[model samples]
Target: MAWVYLFLGGVFEVGFTTCLRFTDGFRNIPWTIAFGICIVLSMVFLEVATRNSIPLGTGYAIWTGIGALGTVAIGMMFFGEAATFVRIFFVLGLVACIAGLKLTSGH
Candidate 1:
């Protein structure tokens, strides 16, 4: 259950970041509101997840890992960002580390 919340928080972190990009430096009102909501909800979920079985360090690392990797993918696919091999390689490595942390956790 804590893992579930943690993963959800990570997912929302991507949404929050994407919405931030769409805000165009906060000039877009709707996207800015969405960004605020996403950030708030993501933090709430992270807090709850960390309060449960998962350690705060591991949970935060996973949350940030997902957010960074997902945002990069979304940027490449939708925002016309580059998809270089080195970037992809590092992203994969980050994912492996995140999975390892989850797998090796006491929880």
Candidate 2:
């Protein structure tokens, strides 16, 4: 359950970051509002997950890992960002690291 919340929080982190890109530096009211909602939800979920069982350090690393990976994928797929081989390699490595953390978490 805590892992679920953490994953949801990570997804919301992606949402907030994507919305941030559309916000036009907070000048776009709709996207700005969306960003605000996502960020709030993300934080709430993170707080819940961390308070439950996951350690703060591991939880934070996982959160940011998910956010970074999702954002990069979103950028490449939707925003025409480059998907270079090295970038992909590092992303895969990050995935392994995240998985390692989860497997060792003893949750």
Candidate 3:
């Protein structure tokens, strides 16, 4: 269940990050509100997962991993960011690290 919470938090992390791009430095009220809500919700879920006996370091690494991976993809797909070969390679490396962290965590 903690894993569920953790993953949900990651999903929300991606959402908030995507919304952040649209916020225009908090001048866009709707996107800013969405970003604010998602940030709070993401933190709540992360805190819950940590409380469930997930190692703090492991949980935080995974959370930020998910955020990073998701943000890169969003940048490519939605924001016209270049998806160069080098970028793809690094993103895949990030995936490997995230997976390795999960497997080694002994959760």
Steric clashes per prediction: 0, 0, 0
Error of 3 at 29 (Å): 1.1
Query: How well does model 2 score by local distance difference test?
Result: 0.96
lDDT of 3 at 92: 98
lDDT of 2 by residue, 1-107 (tens): 99999999999999999999999989999999999999999999999999969998899999999999999999999999999999999999999999999999888
Highest-TM-score candidate: 2
Each model's TM-score? Answer: 0.95, 0.97, 0.95
lDDT score of model 1?
Answer: 0.92
Output the lDDT of residue 44, model 3. 91
What ranges in model 3 sit over 4 Å off? none
Task: Report the backbone clash tally of model 3.
Answer: 0
Give lDDT: candidate 1, residue 14: 97
> Which one wins on lDDT?
2
How accurate locally is residue 5 in candidate 2, as Cα lDDT from 0 to 100? 94
> What ranking emerges by TM-score with the best candidate at the front?
2, 1, 3
Model 3 poorest 10 in a row by lDDT? 52-61
